[model samples]
Target: MTATPRAVDAKEILLTWLTDQVSVPVVSTRPDNKDAPATFVRLLLTGGTGRHDRALHTTQLTIDSYAPTTAAAVELALAVDAAVHGAVAGLSPVVRVSGTSPSESPDPDTTSARATATYQITTRLLT
Candidate 1:
């Protein structure tokens, strides 16, 4: 008998991975604290796709790197890109990772500088 496939929480998997791999704090949303760390990473699930006949899922994630300076933010973004690509071999659920739209920009509402990148990740669903 074939087992049923289950939905994969890509955000949680990545959060755990980035938290262990990156130097800065990794969060799904911006911290509510007024004194939040100057350097941090935020992960957002933009969109995804799932195959009806296959136990495979693809997700689009936007990663925002925030720091005190634009250059620092950009550097952090690059680091995140590298980390995500480098660690794929160890992450079983993750089958592929493709990145795009790396840019350096500052947050408008806050003083922190922001750099952004989008990654398309394909994963094998657990059954």
Candidate 2:
């Protein structure tokens, strides 16, 4: 079995996958100096579960897609959903991506919108 990948590893896997499949920036945090792009994605590790004696884990994460319009945000989110909804080959510890749940809202005080896609990834725990 593969060793469990760290949270950063999981994020990198997701970032690479998203950047390869979609033509947009996939970031871990909002950019500090530059103006936010018209469309971008942020990957966040929300939670996880593992057992003491077992080498298996389930990780949860959210991919937040931001865009200038609700329709655009939804479209970007759907694309991410399609990318993550099933097994992805690159994640080291992640054996499979089980599913995704979606939510959407307007970015604070702006015309921009955000679509958050939550994912559940099954992995082999490493120790």
Candidate 3:
């Protein structure tokens, strides 16, 4: 619904933002069956919907951070949350971000920790 035929890929935008802000590598999906980096982030598009009449769309995103230690994971997660919670408006293609919730967990690797931060973004198509 943008003025042009192209629609913004919110997930990719967030991934780039995280990569730039966090100074960590971000991937859209975990590799087929390989161990992820000891300190990295993964971006997932959990949900999305659009309203044709208003030319508006909402995307739900989850950013997962992994670190070698719980403390590091928490710090990284906090950084990710801060970077995303109010960042959409500054990015290209224009979007508003909200509804942030961050969680931390011990990774199955036992030696690593993981943190997940979720956010909802609403984007309006240019007329």
In the range 23-119, model 3's lDDT, one tens digit per residue, is: 7778887543456577888888898665444666677888788887777887888888888865765676646677556677665644668888777
Q: What are the lDDT scores of the predictions, listed in order?
A: 0.86, 0.73, 0.73
Query: Deviation in angstroms for 85 in model 1?
Result: 1.1
For 73-120, candidate 2 gives per-residue lDDT tens digits of 989998888877533565466677855555786667556788887787
Q: For candidate 2, give the lDDT.
A: 0.73
Off by over 4 Å in 2: 1-8, 32-34, 51-53, 86-92
Assess the local accuracy of residue 44 in candidate 3 as a C-alpha lDDT between 0 and 100. Answer: 83
lDDT, candidate 3, residue 82? 83
Give TM-scores for every candidate, taking all chains together and pairing residue i with residue i: 0.91, 0.77, 0.79
Show pairs that collide, candidate 3: none
lDDT score for candidate 1 against the true structure: 0.86
The model with the greater lDDT, 1 or 2, is 1
lDDT of 3 at 40: 80
Of 1 and 2, the candidate ranking higher by TM-score: 1
What value does the lDDT take at residue 62 in candidate 2?
A: 80
